[model samples]
Target: MALASLAAASLPTAAAAVRSRVSLLRRAMAASPSSSSCAGLAGSPARVGVVQMTSVGDLDANYATCSRLTKEAASAGVKFLCFPEVFSFIGSKDGESIKIAEPLDGPIMQRYRSLAKESSMWLSLGGFQEKGPDDSHQYNTHVLIDDSGEIRSSYRKIHLFDVDVPGNMVYKESRFTTAGDTVVAVDSPFGRLGLTVCYDLRFPELYQCLRFKHQAQVLLVPSAFTKVTGEAHWEILLCARAIETQCYVIAAAQAGKHNEKRESYGDSIIIDPWGTVIARLPDRLSTGFAVADIDLSKVEAVRTKMPISEHRKFDSDWKTS
Candidate 1:
């Protein structure tokens, strides 16, 4: 089947790329709005919260942490909540993720839907391993649930993390997962949101398309950054994306040590267009959350001042070899 046909037929169930399920949910909601239960949350300034999880191989433990943190964020008047990558379970080894992969209509997604509805908040799951038919592949997916508990928008991690970082940090996402070909963004009360996952951060062009083409005012980057790179590049890169694009960036990260001898740098943050960190979690346990208010006016103000979008000069000599 063609890639579009395959994607249309079923939710992208490729485990390595995060946010595929959310992308699927977005398409579904767009196709049939009545099927979704969540209502749109509207306002110029959006109160956003993020959940950071130091997920282990245990599903129960991860779910409990998400539930608790979500409740806390809701109590704090957070209307939009985002979670870290692999919020359900981060396995100890490769292939171990397949064991925990569930279908889109399974218990895991259902739980998230219920949570969004009960809290009366728009929710975004960073990424999950969703089981596909025949169980051959699992999608690394993100999902957005509206305040009314209806699924809103979703995106698969288009840029697979298939590179070899020095010091033995090697990831071959294409080995077990499929790549997403399309970029996705969604409209909400907060503004247009560009959805992406961990590895996608390295590609600035994707953000350019999202910002310039889709008019995305906010970008959501849910990550499980490794210690080696996160310490050096995580914050800086995130800030740069926000500054360059003049958009709000919300990055909910996985922190602390996991059972597989892997340590994640946990510094989940919300950055404004001016590249200011509004909220962050102090280093501690592997699980927690942060909340911040996003003002769309700031995005407009920055864009108006810089006007980078309007001033574009392309040299004929510019070429890619």
Candidate 2:
């Protein structure tokens, strides 16, 4: 089914940039005399930020960009900061990435953890390359760091990118990486968060398991989506997931042309429960970050009105046990 059918009917207009939407929200919040008067809410809004980068093969350049943007988010009072897929390095060729692949406890992970602690914000590293025990294989993984700088959880990209898109857009991630067999979600101060990497976003079942089975309140998609496909379906699919699951969606994207040949569509966005673009960064840049105060109460209010969770219909024909 087309993903747009599952979402609200609001295509973002040119006038509705992230900054303007946020400014309007702040004004509304200020205008309300009491927090209870707005949305009949119970808790304070959580501040979330996303970092979008135009990462290339240079490790130093990528690290510098991450460092600068993450610090900027922290200074702006973001409680949680997230990066894009393969934030460390995206090489010119496939096997070339193996050169930069490090262990889970390597310098790259350590640096990110230290940064999380220093900034006093929860950090989600999009996806990194980790060298497996053998020399022939690696794992595409996302690492979550708590505010205390501890590695809270890690999720490997379960659904590998093994597609042959027309016009030379062929990528067989299984060529160098092994697939993960598990779904992962972690608990955070703001809410429960489901974590997934680039290609995993296409699989709605994975997200269903995260939302329905695991009870995730937020979904994180750290991706380096290709320009060819992202333009056609990125925002629609993200909003669909948010509206259908009643969860906040934060997608940190790798935007702009990377090398002489590779290009990525960078329109990093944070969508609220009502399928609204609360925050977004520009399409091209070395360093850009967006912050939004997500009111968790909206999740409860939406779900209370439409109790899809309790009204689930089981498919007896598709029963497995």
Candidate 3:
């Protein structure tokens, strides 16, 4: 299917109308506290880092870039750091991704786990090319690692990028990647986080499900968005998700040319619940990270005033399992 068709099909009906309703913000607004992996750092502000990169087919080189960025974030006192999709490697040749795919417990991931432990920080390894069921395919997995270096949760990419760009560029991600059937949410000191990959940002219903069903207070969109689409829809789509879901949206992105055939739009950004851009890289092509403080109070404050969850009249219509 075409990109427009896929987008139109995935989106739910226009958001439900708001009704007059009042409810407890903490109790009624966000994800279940019980579902969180750790205690909520309620009153405190947690610092986060969003790393942007220009990854290529070289695994060792990418690892080195990530290490430098991680050290910089640690020096800035960031507690949780996010890396973009294809953080480990972006293939420059056909069959390279599938050839290099590894399991979650493989050496590549283990190295990243060690990095998190050594840095004493939580890590969102956005997209790893996990070995799939066959020799020709892989799973684009988004993994969350705790500060203790244990795997917290993993979400595979549900929405694949299979679009035809105007500039004679066509992507068929499904050709070599399997779509994930699960929606994953996990607890962190920051809040309950909804994990999604690059193309997933185009769909609002997923974000709604996160806010309503999973009670996600923060959303992670780790992407290697193409330069064309990123320039057009990336930030706007991110801000829309933040405002509509009443959640913080953290996007770590791939910037600049990765290989001869591909280039990414870099502008790693953090948006607040009110649709405000809090932190973004000034130089979009720079291999660096952006820092911001995640204030749960602000998340509560925004949802309390709006109370969209309680006021939504078509709750049954758009609710997802």
TM-score of 2: 0.84
Can you write out model 1's per-residue Cα lDDT over 1-321, one digit (the tens) per residue? Answer: 000000001113246434553454345334532221111223456788766778889888888878787788777777888888888888888788877788777898888898888888888887788774445567778787888888787777777666555564566776766665567778887778889888677667678767766678889999887776787688888999999899899998988888756777778888999999887776534366777778887788898999998885443457878
Query: 38-143 in candidate 3: lDDT tens per residue?
Result: 3364558889988888999999999998888787788888889999998999998878999999999999999899999999999999989999888899999999
RMSD, each candidate, Å?
9.6, 12.0, 8.3
Pairs clashing in candidate 3? 31-215
Lowest-scoring 10 consecutive residues by lDDT in candidate 3? 1-10
Candidate 2 clashes between residue pairs 3 or more apart in a chain or in different chains: 255-266
Question: After TM-score superposition, what is the CA distance of residue 212 in candidate 2 from its true location, in Å?
Answer: 0.9
Which structure is stronger by TM-score: 1 or 3? 3
TM-score of 3: 0.87
Tens-digit lDDT track of model 2 for 194-260: 8899877766766776777667788999998887678777898899989888889999899888898
The residue ranges of model 3 lying beyond 4 angstroms of the native Cα positions read 1-41, 315-321
TM-scores of the models, in the order given? 0.83, 0.84, 0.87
TM-score of 1: 0.83
